[model samples]
Target: MKEIDKIALIEIKNRQILHVRSKGKLKFYLPGGKREASETDEQTLTRELHEELSININTNTIKYLGTFKAPADGKADGVLVKITCYTAEYTGNLKPANEIEELRWLNNSNLDIISEASKKIFEFLKQKGEID
Candidate 1:
């Protein structure tokens, strides 16, 4: 089984979580991407946000949420995505940049539109009373 490592930022506000839909994709996901060579989780998340959303993440405010693993999106069953999640403060207006096609705020009701990994994250947040 191949393991893919990625970072995700769990941006929440007013009981809603931020999610983005990639171009040509049906699922929405938390804003983030794969780690670059020798880069730390924080670095990867920062770079991904800048590239995908044109925003700067505040590193100091980043808080580790938890890690989750699930079948990689659109990949073989044995392929899995090992995601490290964090919550952080960001600068700049949220907009769809780069390959992102749409940006939306999701609550519990929007779980079906996201990936399996993200659905797990949403459940975790809901259990902690972080999202409505």
Candidate 2:
């Protein structure tokens, strides 16, 4: 089994989660990416957020949300993605940047359009009373 280690930002507002779709992708996902060598979770998420969303994640406000594992989207069977998620305050207008093509705020009702890992996240958030 192959596991992809990724860090993600969980930005929820008014019961909606901020999700992004990369260029040519069909599924929306949490904003983040794989951890670079020698980078901590905070550093990884901060850099990824800046690159993908044109925002600066305030490290001081970073809080661990949870880790989710699911079949890696667009990958072969037996491959899994382990997303380590964090909620943090950020500065700057959220816009698609880098490889991101669009951004959307999503809730549980939109489950059919998100990645499997993201579905797990939405469920977790719902169970915690953080979203509908």
Per-model TM-score versus the true fold: 0.96, 0.98
The superposed Cα distance between candidate 2 and the true structure at residue 119, in angstroms, equals 0.6
Computed on alpha carbons, the lDDT of every model, listed in order, comes to 0.92, 0.95
Model 1 scores a C-alpha lDDT of: 0.92
CA lDDT for candidate 2: 0.95
- In terms of lDDT, the poorest run of 10 residues in model 2 is 6-15
List clashing residue pairs in candidate 2: none
Question: Which model scores highest in lDDT?
Answer: 2
For candidate 2, lDDT tens digit of each residue in 1-132? 999999999999889999999999999999999999999999999999999999998889999999999999999999999999999999999999989999999998899999999999998999999999
lDDT tens digits by residue: candidate 1, 13-70: 8999899999999999889999989999999999999999999999999999899998
What TM-score does candidate 1 get on C-alpha atoms? 0.96
* Candidate 2 residue spans exceeding 4 A from truth: none
